[model samples]
Target: MIAAPLREKKRYGWFDAALRALLEETDAALEAGVDVPEEPGGWWHQYVCPTHGTELRFDPREREATAFRCPHGCVLEGEAYRGAWLVFKHQERARTALSAAAMYAATGEAKYAEAANAILEAYASRYPRYPVHPDAQPWMLKGRAFHQALTEAIWATTILRAFLLLRDEGALQVDAAASDVFFAMVSSSMTEYRRILIEERDEPANNYTAWLNACLACYYAVRDDRDGMETLVSARGGLRHHLEIGVLPDQLEFEGSLYYHVFVLRAYFIAAEMAERLGFDATAWTGSAGQSFRGMLEALVGLAAPNGELPALHDGPYSRPPYAREIAEVFEIGYARYGDARFAPILREAYRRADGGCGGGTGSAERRGLEAVLYGEGDWPAAEPLREPSRLYASAGFAVLRHADNPLSLLADFGPHGGSHGHDDKLNVVLMHRNGFVLPERGMVPYGSELRRRWFARTPSHNAVSVGGRTQAPHTGVCLRFDAEARRSYAWLRSEGAYAGATLDRHLWVDRDVALDWFEVRLDLEETVDYWLHFAEPLNVGGGWTACTPDAAPGEDEAYGYVATSARWTAEEPFAAVAATCGGERVTASLLAVPGGELYRIASPGTSVDPSRPLDGLLYRARGRRATFVAAFAAGDAPIRLARGDEGSVLVAPAGGGGTAMRFRMTEHGLHRE
Candidate 1:
């Protein structure tokens, strides 16, 4: 069997950076000493500020101290904060142990080995005494070191990696008895985690199950247990089963979040690497539907924006892009495994974007962390900017339309309601322009926060239509038509069950500088319909508007309760415009006024988990059995005029009065443009 690359120290850019960081972290741990709490740690999600719903600030130097402070100068104490701090300590210990093991392997230092062994022995000695957490939900599998079995699996994987490095380096030979105890404890923990996964986790395809399988695979590899490995592979919800069912035909994760897609793929990569090091043919493994790791990597490559960021769809962190090192490491592994040239540009771009593209700085140090040290091949090919065209991932339920020359792109979600992590936002649209999100999708807050369910996941928080002030029911949407050309692109989608008795259809047209939208809803009964849109910048309405009382606001239930200040206007003419200035660029939207349409400009929560930074929102409401909304969005202040055209078609042209008018007709077959 080939030795793992992590066992050898290499001379490369990323390697040097990783080694430096590891040494600093290990030295810090050595100075601070190890601290294992008698009580189990709390759930990590509970570490957020209660008032703001943001994460509490944790300084590692103050790990021994108890008081935790939020970013806004609020201090929190008691069991929740203390328990959460303990969890952070455990995580730091696991990471330090791995770093010390690697440092010992590279430098043959006795001090590093001692530090690593101390952490392992401490955990092993206390493993049996730590009680299962009391706060676990009925559906959750309780853990000893952490609140959930999922976290235990994560913590154990790091510890096992550290142990494997020490064992392979022969450092464990000095303390044979302690080594045996550690091994036994880890083996027992793996067994319990596996049992929990098989019996308790009904969804083998979940991201949590992925981590559990990774832990089991790592342990089996360490023991050279072929039978154990086979059992895990063939189990009902094991690695292979997850690949077959959890990966969609489009090769994206079934959860519909890029974050989880990369997350689950990381677990699979870890398990496969372990299997390969153990002389197992894991690289050749594929799902029944030919779902290979290469396909998954290719899907990410295609979905990445020109700047190498992905759209934060569904329940994901809206503000955070893929870490420079994280994505660089992913593509490094991809290039090594598949030798795909397409992976090269992404790697180069990630590195270039790291720390403001500075050659030597903290950013560069971060970009050159553990993944790059272990997987990267030193030099990367030069990056050529991506000239990506529009794409449609049909099976995964997403469509992207891009302008040829600029960074303007539109993403439409008309796919399966992602299970539990999914939001009530089918047929929602997000617009990305000039390297920023103009029409943003407020991804989600922490699951522990009530705002996650109350505001972030509701239909009104997204750029979609809601019925009678209620969130849309979970439903899948289908793409009716998609056509792309050099000058124009068009897509239409239909959702029948987003509302119980209504069917929603949305059509979009994209050109060099503008996007046109036509949304129509047919209902069984007369009900109020609201077309919702949220902007990244404050919106300023022009022409025919007046102040209104708070009672005149849209719906007050569901997410609407969060809407603070509002203004209302009745459009007497056929056209109304609202505009916002973003990064010195003007973004304008022109709407075709309905007979009794009431337009509103309001301040609401933006794409941030923090409620303090609110964004501008536009709500267009009309009451009828059938409602239609037509609008045009552009980068500059060219207001668009809309009117009825020949044969019930819609006519749209720049209100500035120079461009030729375009006609759009929607039919059962598709949308036609002339």
Candidate 2:
């Protein structure tokens, strides 16, 4: 039998060792005397660029000291040099380096040209010496450190693009002195990235870090680094091994988090892209590169709410990126390559939803879908145009959009249970309508370490089952270990048309049932735990007063209980049971109900909200073993059973057998076979 590949034996020493040495030498030089001269009028800096930390010595005295060298020796002029390196200081720094270099070439000013050259030279000089940071040691476990890593990666990509721009535009008019350094920098950077992949492959603790490393490797591979490409592929294989070993594929059971799913898609997307670039023939992979691309895109599209946002869980310090922008690019690229445009609209909607790019309007689901297709319903072109909002975070949502044509709705969960950016939303499914959304994910926002840990990462922020009487594990105060079972979600279009909708079934455990409605939902979580479903939107009650139990306390971890209020009070039915409970140890199951004036009071939140939305319903909590509550709704004379359960208490509303509306709440012991 063949033995597993050994890490030490892998080959990259020839180039990697040299790169590390050069980078160290450059770092010392920059620390020693490399300084950006203080200009009188404009901003010149002796400070380091917080992101990549390239040294800068900018001098305004252009005539005598026509050039200022970074440690790597690429020279730069006064203002342009400042713009080239410091992105946080100015927006122009975000532009491609090639563009910045062009500005200098056009002016024929030695200082400006040198400023650009300095950036390239600095990188080049250390290129052969820069070692991979990941291989040095373990990264800090704190969320802030991980966050910093994320930022650095983003900044580095932009800098790389600038270099590409310079090279593409023929703006590197300097002698080999500068050119050699620039090439070395590129090579060194690639080698460092290779090291990251190697480490991730050897030991991947965090899926996000793994994916980020894979993305770096893909970038290098596309730049024609064969070693880098293979390393990433090998890392991917290692990740898969861990998953297969630690996780159950058939039924994904996550404690509560969506971070892993997001990163998994990211790794796949980058790997697929890089593979295609290397002429590996993406078709060999399951469903082809186009399929993989479309699968991820559609996944993002389907994950989005009607309002084009995701849920409150798993959201943190990282700003949400534009989903549509990425879908558009990937879909267009795949379409051009494979001649398939079926999922093109998936990309379009992602853009439209994320960036308001559909052109027609906002909040119109139909229009968004139509706009996406209409825009891309054109003939194939050699190369499509690229637009703004290309950030990776923004593109994260495109995973769903890319998977538009996939037969199954994918669901995954894995990641840390606590700490920053943790969302107690494990085993969640990115559901799909026959065509669009069902219970769309609420988009994330900037991370607030304190707030996130306190509330955002809690149980009520996701779609899952609550155990005992709480959303989290009683012992650990985190989520419990519950596996997903018999996962399946796929639908076909019917004559009812685009708005008719489709059915999705993401079964958990053995035979749990989860059903959805236009404005309300009914889930018989027999095999699961006490159900706790969260709505990103607030509930609107039209009648009685609102109320709840074990409600919000000062600074306590939000426990389970009932919190509800009346929507309307018309003399006949005045008091509203905001939320109520019946059976269990003190309070186990809790029910939260809302009335829509229609028959389905316990239905899922509707896709269409009034142009002017109303305040959402009160949150319900339970701490015991069982609970129940009944909400009333005017169903236009229809006697509808919103929901019913056997083990726990069931809320029941009777509108006088057809009296327009009815009322309900928990029964005696919590049995509601009625």
Candidate 3:
């Protein structure tokens, strides 16, 4: 039997610090006690503030309170909110049981063991009686304790870890008969979980499958069932198959969402750690194409922004406080497993930005968590600052161009359409400064929100061109050329199927101070196309703009209907400028003239859930079978001039005509800059 590491005392300062933190949390849990709701939980996503369209707040400490409150002054009571409270209770019970079990192993405290046993026994007794969630979709695998099998898998994995720790410490030896009963019930539920995952939701290349596999691996390891383990590894949609197919060649999770990427990584990491404890070679396992967990870690490290947060591409939250803390814990585990030095900067930054700390020590060591206590090294790695260069992940379909000293960076998405969770915004781009996003992707909203389909997931929410006011069709984009130099980086991408019988091409050039964008579209039939740019901060458009509503508000049936305010401009000059202030820094964009193009300034919902908060946007519309547009963007007071050049080329130069001029042209080969 594998002995729990926390059972033995260690002389490491980091370990002690992390242990102190865990014990504090465990003490709090013990005081609060466990509350197992008699009714099963509903979909957590449904617990949204109906008025504000944001998640409702529930105080875990107030276990009996049923009226959920939103961050705004809205209060909601009833089935969905109450059911969501039950979900919270179930989650807290599982987490508290784990903390208690760890404390019992570390300190041999009977009180901790009793607390853990009480929660586990309560769950075991009630597991068979809870009905499958009523709100679950017909195609989805339902759960007894939670709404979906995915969430049930997550709960079971945590609970089993607690159970295994207690079992290994011989805490359960006192009453073997009761322990046996608990194991039989929980293990039977796990078997049903495995059956549903394998027989019903047979998605080999999905994050859901990874969680299902983790739960099954934990169960088999606890039972010491070698045959079951082997079967899980060898089955068609099992662990090995998921690992091989779900992780793309570029090492990103196939979903193309940074949040889901980390989510899937956490599940696999847990499974690998459990397998290693069972004396298996799972940690050393490699996929068919030689992909390994180490490669995936490297991919994450490569994708970290200068602030160490991953971009909220596709369907994920922007890396902020609580989420950043969770990401730090994941990085701590990765550093322990691989000893990679690149993770140090991200770990340090994440901890520094985390909302609260354990008050244990200064610097990175201050914010240690359970992972750090269990697996971290004694001496913390130096938090060396990163000076990343512009690069492209061809397989993953992302190109990042970083300006010197990290003042400006642009991420261009030109790869495969992320399955299901992907936004229909091909050739979408997100621009950022050292502080935050300039043109941001609204990432995603809760799955239960109508706005998720009506606005956030649509093409208008991103920085891309929409044809016929319709979202782009699901399609992969191809990078035509990518080049990085000492002062400039350039990329050209093409998508043929974003619209049927049409071709879309984009050229992006980033210099030390300015970015030039050229977008071209050719359709077999005449159609109206609109180029969109959304700003995180409010924007001011200049050059004789007048308030006016168009024939329709852009797209009445589409995401454009969310536009609450509008203004129009028919430029007298060949160029128009729009500017925004971010963190007291002025950023400006200069648009080159399009023949007969109509420019509109609009305000739309700023975030996925909050419609009351508005974001500024610029929409340039043209009606034709073919269209081309050029624009230049820069920080501060740089005057940028964009104009048509000789031989189908575009010219970007200083407005006063003194600075170095750059000429760009698209050829049959690729984009060329001179």
Model 1 pairs in collision: none
Q: lDDT of all the models against the reference?
A: 0.74, 0.32, 0.74
Number of clashing pairs per prediction, in order: 0, 115, 0
Where model 2 places Cα greater than 4 Å from the true spot, the runs are 1-150, 161-202, 205-279, 282-295, 298-342, 353-422, 426-443, 463-471, 474-538, 546-615, 621-624, 628-674
Specify the poorest-scoring 10-residue window by lDDT in model 2.
491-500
* Number of residue pairs clashing in candidate 3, backbone atoms closer than 3 angstroms, sequence gap of 3 or more or interchain: 0
lDDT of 1 by residue, 1-674 (tens): 11355545465455666667667757876677765656778777677776876667655555475788876788888887787788777877887787787788777788888888788778877776777778766767677788887778778878877878888888853355655565566567657766666677555677887887888888887778888888777787776888888898888899888767877887788778767666677767788777878888888766665545555688876643234545665677887777776776666556654534421122332335445545666455455545567888898898888768644667899998888878888989987765456787766665777788898888988999998888999889999888878988888989998888999999988887568888999999999999988887787797688877655655745688877546877657767888887555888888888778788877776564455567788888899999989888877766667787888688888647678888888777766776
lDDT of 2 by residue, 466-491 (tens): 33334444211111122222331211
Q: What digit string (tens of lDDT, one per residue) describes model 3 on residues 1-674?
A: 12346745366656666777778777776676765667778777777765666666655566576678876788778987887778777887887887778777777789889888888777777776777677877866677788888888888888888888888777753244554565555556656766666577655576777888888888888788778778777776676777788888788888788888888887887777677666678765778776678888777766666545467788875433445555776777777666777787677766654533221122342545554554455455655545578878887798877768436678889888887888887899887766556787766666767777788878888899888878888889999889888878888888898888789998887877677788999999999988989887888776588888644445634787876446877668767888887557888888888888887887877665355567798888898999998878877755577778788887777544577778878887666777
- Which ranges of candidate 1 are over 4 A from the true structure? 1-31, 103-114, 168-176, 189-202, 319-329, 339-366, 383-385, 540-551, 569-574, 579-586, 636-648, 654-658
Give me the runs in candidate 3 sitting further than 4 Å from their true place. 1-31, 103-114, 167-186, 189-202, 319-326, 348-366, 369-385, 403-406, 484-487, 540-544, 548-553, 569-573, 581-586, 609-611, 637-639, 654-658
RMSD of each: 3.8, 16.0, 3.9
Q: What does candidate 3 score in Cα RMSD to the true structure?
A: 3.9
